[model samples]
Each structure stands twice: as C-alpha cells, then as structure tokens.
Target: MMYTVQSSGMLLKRFSANYVQNSTRLASFRQCERYGKFHDCRKRISHWLKAQGEQVAQACTKQCEFIIAQRIRRSLQIFHLYTRIWDEVALKEFMKSWRNRALRNSRHFLMSSIGITMYNWDRERITKDELNGYKKEIEGIYRLRDSTVVCAKCQLRIVIDVRQSGIKYCTCTDNKFNATSNQDSEGWKPYIEREDMLIWRREEPNCGGLFAYKVYGSFAEVTAEDFLQAQIDVDYRKEWDPTARELRIIDTDPASQSSADSHSDVIYWETIWPKLFANRDYVYQRDWVVDKERRLIIIISKVTDHPAAPSKPGTYRVTTYWSYMVIRPYTEFHQPGIEFGLTYFDDPGVNIPSAVTAWVAMTGLPNFLIRMREASRNYQNYKIAKQSLDASDTNYVPLKNEDIFEDKVLHGNMQNSERSEILNGKNVEDYNKIEHTEVPQFNEDLKEEEEEEDSTNSSEEGRGLLDYFYLAKLFA
Candidate 1:
C-alpha cells in the first residue's frame, strides 16, 4: 500500500495505513471486525472473560473428558487428554467462576487496564481512498517489524546448555556488581537535588519520621541525609543540614554513599516493572509459527475443477509419510505463552482430522491456536489424496525399521537420527494406519521414512522407542 505524495511540487514516496498505528487493531480486524469494535478498553474485561472462557473450557471440560474417556493413561497423559477435548465441553464452570472473580475484584488491573477508556481509536466509516491511504500507512508500520534478515539460509542455532560449574577456563570476563563505590556520599547532593521528591510513607500521622521517594521510574526507598550529600561536588552551590533534611547546591561528600543495600533494592524493582506490564499479547504470539509466507495457488471452487481442502472429509487419504508425525510438549514456557508443535509431511496420505482443532485443544494457548488454524489452511494442495489409501501391496512391504529415539531437550541432539535398520516390514498403509492411531507408531515409522534412521538398534538399556513415549495411543 505505497503511495506517491506530491508535496511542494516534489514527489515523495511514503507509506501509511490504518493498521500501522496498532498491531492489536490490525491483527484483531484481520480476525473479525466484531472483535475489533467491541473488545476495546471499555469492553476489555468482557473480552478478557471471553479469553478466560477458553481457559475455563480448558480446565473444566478438558478435565471432564479425561474422567469420561474410554482409554486411561498417566496423570500427565490425563492432562494432555484434557487439552485435546477442551473445546468440546458443553459447559464451562471455570469461565463462570473467573467472570464472577473479575466482577467482584474491581482491582486496579481489572478496572484501569481492561477498561475501554485506555486507548485512542477512530470510529468513522472510511471511504475507498481513505482506506487505501490507511492501507499504505499500515504497510509502513509493518515494515518496522521486517527485520534485516542477516542470513536467509541460516541454520537453526544449536542450543546447548553447558553446566556452569564444569567450565574451567573462560575466555570472557564477567562483570561483578560493585555497589560499594556507588554508596559514597560524594554524589548525594546531586542525587537529592534531582530525586528528592518525597511522599509521606502513610496517610496516618503516627507513621513517624518515615518518608519514601522515587529512586528510579519504578522504585521507592526511605530517604536519608547521607544519600543527599553523596551527589554533590565541590564548588557546587548547594548546602545541607542533616537534622532538618535540608539541602542546597553545595559540595557533596564522596564517602556519604553508605548503605549499598538501597541501590540493590532500586535495581531489583527497575528490572521488574516493565516486564510485568509489557505487551502481554507478544507472549501469547510467541508460541505460534506466525505470519507464514509461502507460495500457494489461489484456489476457488468450480464445476470443471475443485479446490481440495485437508479439512473437508474424504478429500484426503491417510498417507504414510505425513501421517506419522512426532510432537513433544514444551510445557516449561520461558515466557508467558502456550506450548505446542505441529509438523505435517508433504506426501503422507493419512488424513489429519481437523488438525487445527486438535492443536487448539492440545496446547490451550489461544493465540497459538488461532495462528495454527489460519496458517494450516493454505496446505490444501498438499492433501494426501484418496488414491493413496490403496497403495499397500502386502508383498511390496515398505521395510519396517528399528526405531531411533533421542532426548533432544535433555541432550544436544535434536532427536534426529542418521542410523536406521529396515527390519521385518508391512505395507506402508498399515504403518500409516497405526501411526494415525498411535502417536508412537508414527515415531517408530519415522525410522523407516527418513534416510538417517538406517542403522540397527543396539542400545536397549532404557525404554524401547515405542515404550519411551508417555502415551502413544492417540496417534495409533
């Protein structure tokens, strides 16, 4: 949405759009207009409640499914199953409970944060030209997020955690915190001159001589005459009387910076304030493979030819290649976010039964779920065609292979293997069927599929490839 601007008889190239002003506004509009209109600050809690509705659904309904399920597994597995059936629940006790809590709380975050009065937005009908102008504006805004990718073909960084105590020689010098010098009284006069705006510690008069002042934008500490004297320098105009808590622009005592403890407390709060109130949506968005750009044919329905969709029943067959996929939950989120993974093979013929729905229910992360649902839709052409259903010739059995398994999260290897051995075999269709039914079966079948899993299994101390999985039945 670029436009040519003629200003002062010179053509200037610029961009603008309605979306450029706010990511939430743009992304929300792309999702649905009703969401964008009613979910502003005034309606934020209502929207938040809707979000909690999903969370509640995740808790109550998801848990209920595990209780009523025909198949039973471990407690962890039960939690996993709960996620799979979360959206299917008919009632949400959790949502009702959370909404009640919100209404009753009337706390600061509930009142000030989610309230509609917090933001500025335009709410008028826009004409085509006006819309186009906004479009260009937004394109410009998005350009900021378009990073100057250093390496388009960069390999994934190997994340290997080294034990801190094991390192003997270090090449880099780590900076040790030195708060002692900062405690000197020399800077006190200047420090008080700049930051000595004081507040009564409490409204009660009996709170005594206690007073607090903002040290940084985020921290507060009790005031002392010493802190004030440390900030001044010789030849400065200030003076101070310790008893009266008075100061003028006089020379400061460098040694007056005693009590290094106050600075530590200030540092702690300075580190915490922004993180607690920072953009929470980015935390949620982190879980997803967001804003994917790929080459896809513009598909439309027609009498002469039909656009195939993976979502439509019978449009695809369960193929062996993609039918067997492996996923391990990433429950320990480094940040506030959902955790899950999805990998589909290009040639596998096994039907992915509402994979988007499955993943949404599986992770219980709303933003991640939405991203996956929208992103997975462009793969209709990669559908496992129905013809693949009958590709199995019993005699021409695709050689079954010994499974290869590695704990990548616990180890440096990414669970990818290059050693595989083709063992007694079965038709690939059978393997595909098992994969669709058992999660582990797919992982086992992977040894057969990939070029790396070509060696014989010799290690047998731990769980076998199939037995190692927490619960593999869902894929079967």
Candidate 2:
C-alpha cells in the first residue's frame, strides 16, 4: 500500500535525537503515542497454568491438540478456502514465521508446522448461506487481499494449497521465504488503503518545528515541550483478574469521546472463555487452532522479562525497550460500549510495579486517587483550555498531554491499524460482527492436576498478533 501524501502534513519524530533508532521505535511510536497497547496492565496474568486458564485452555487444547496430533481428517473444501486466507495472513505475518531453535530443521517440517494456505478463487467458491451456507465458518478469519505489499528488505510469501508465491520485495521473518521478484499490482492499492499508516500531525500553535523529535540511539526524544510538561499517560483497565476470578475494565482514556468505555465499563465474570491457547509452543510455532465458539479474534502477546530499551535523558524520551502491549482492531474502542476485557490473563495489583507508580505520577496523580478530586473537578477546565490552545501557541500551558502520558508512562495500547478491512466485512455479513463474541461460561468443572511444564514456548523469532495483547505490562 502507498502512503505518499504531501498535503502539508507534519513529519513524525522520535522522543530524542541521540537515542538509537529502530523501525519500531522511530516510525511506529513517533507519530503514535506508544508502540504497543498496555493489555498486560493490571491483568491476572500468569505463565503458570491456572485452573481457570487450564480449563478454557483445555477446551481449545482439545481442538488444537487434535490438529497438532494429526488426528482429525480435513475436508478438502474446507481446507482449500482456509488455506488461501491462511496463506494471506501468514504471508502478511511473514515476519512471524522466523525459525526459532525449537522449529524443526527440515523445510517440509517447518512448512507443515507454520500454517495452512489456499487461494482467492478457492475462497470465492465458499457458500456461507445458512440456507446455502456452505461458507467455511472457522475462527480467526481475516483478509488483506485488498491491501498491497511494500518491502525494502522484507520478502513476502503466500503459500496457496501448498503452492508458494512470494514477492521479491518482501521477505518473511529471518529472510527465509523468498518470493518472485515480480510484484503483484492487484492487491497493493487497496491493501495500502486498509492501513492506518502511522500518521504524523503537529497542529496549530505547536508549529511543526516546536514539536520536532529525533532518535539518537535506541530512543525517540522530543526536543521541545512548548505548551506544557509533556508526560506519558496510560489507559489502564482490567480484562480478567484470575485472582479475582472476574473480569473488569477501565477507560484508559476517561475523557475520550465515548460512554461505556471499558475503563468505565465495569462488570463481573459471567462466563469463562475456552482456553485453547498454549504459550508459544516452541520458539517457532507454525500451527494454532481457532475455534469459532471461544475465539473470534485471538490476540497474542508477551511480557518482556525487562524493559525493551533503556531510558535516557532527553526533553521527551521514548524508550525503545519492549513494554506491556496489545494490538487489535482500531474500531474495538469505537464500538459504543466496548472496552478491552481479558479472557486469557489478569492482574490484581498485588505488587504494583514502579512503572505503574511512575504512571500514576505522570497522570498528575502522584499520590494517585488522592489527586482524584483535582482531575474530577478540573476535567472541564482542561476541556476549555483544550479548545483554546493552537498548534503553534507555545503557551507552555499545563497541557493534558494525555497521549504522551499513555505512551511514555502508561505504555499505552496501539490498536491494530492493519486490519483486513476486506475480509472483516465478510465476517460482519456472517455473524453480525459483534465486537465481543460470547466466550465460554465460567464453571466449577475442574479436575486439578499437580502440575504441568511451563508450556510457555516463548518465540523471540516471530511475533504473533497476540503480541499486541499479552506483551502489555500489568500494574497488578
């Protein structure tokens, strides 16, 4: 896809000029606040298999284990279409197919392990008419067919029904799968259209120059904070608290223009979702099963053992290190009352991290709730000032800097701007496209076993869509 717009736009910059810059830090977070969504924020998150996690996981395990064990027979028709979309997503996620130590050495072994692929013609052959509904109804379906590919160093691949077609420009992770040099012009335009390419905006008064940023090492620093002391703001809320054994949510963006925001959407555990996911099964996982019952959109994520990039001194510095994060559809929040709720993991704030403490401070709540009244009463005050401030004002006014607070302090969330607009439409046509599909209902059905191995097949090689969800840090 193409993002060639010169309509007098503001260029994005890193938090600092001296920080070491990488594509993720320099390009991803400069315009956008944080690199990843802080999904791990206050999650009842655990690497250990909790009973609840185990039960739901067990249900999914049944399905995936079946697939992994090669025990289930495949219907050529179903496999045909699934293979195409799988190939599409897999190709798009080529960066995620890197070979880890755990990945078998043989090419065929890895290919079988990686994913299933098919073609567009095969998919068109589907007939999802409940009346004529032969349409393949599987979980976790996305289409980026309308989107195009652009690669400077990355080689793109698409395996259709075991056949392979790759783009010379794009390469899978580890630069392993090589595609033909001939780029397909078919999907490029719409594909580009589907992306919310990191936009760079410096509005009135700030004048583009006042908000300039650059990366020196592994950092992105802001050279100036003209209007106010810029600070990071995180939107924290509970998804599912295993300790609490309940799901909670918060409006990370309280002032955001929406009611019933997740932060604001408080509810209790009414049901338990199926736990079909296993920790990265081996460093290079080529297979996963998505059951329509429990998982409609399966997010993948991880918590860095430590900060992604070290922090340094800069007027406005953005660390290059990994932070607790999540990536999902941009519209998830746009939904009337939708908020990110956890089904996989949770936190109880048993031992709040310094990061969470610092986050509270950055939010002008150094003492936390003690300053609640201040914000509660002054939210309107800030709103008035928010309207009056100009882009280049340089007023040095006490800026809300909400986005900054989220990125630097909160380790905010980065929505999945790269959604497959095309296929997502098809999903909508099928099942009303509900934001939160019904997950498994929580129950007392459990037969606890002493223990199981870590099972956390941490894969540093390929990043999963789940990366956007679990990697987010937790305050609890």
Best by TM-score: 2
User: Over the stretch 363-455, how does candidate 1's per-residue lDDT look in tens digits?
Assistant: 222222222222222112212332222445111111111132121123222232421111101111211122121111112211233222222
Top lDDT hit? 2
Off by over 4 Å in 1: 1-159, 162-466, 469-476
Off by over 4 Å in 2: 1-141, 145-259, 262-316, 319-456, 459-476
Q: Give the lDDT of residue 66 in candidate 1.
A: 75
Looking at model 2, residue 265 earns an lDDT score of: 13
**Candidate 2, residue 400: CA error in Å?**
32
Per-residue lDDT for 255-329 in model 2, tens only?
A: 322321111111121111114322211010010111222211212222221111112232112111111111121
Query: Model 1 Cα displacement at 345 (Å)?
Result: 20
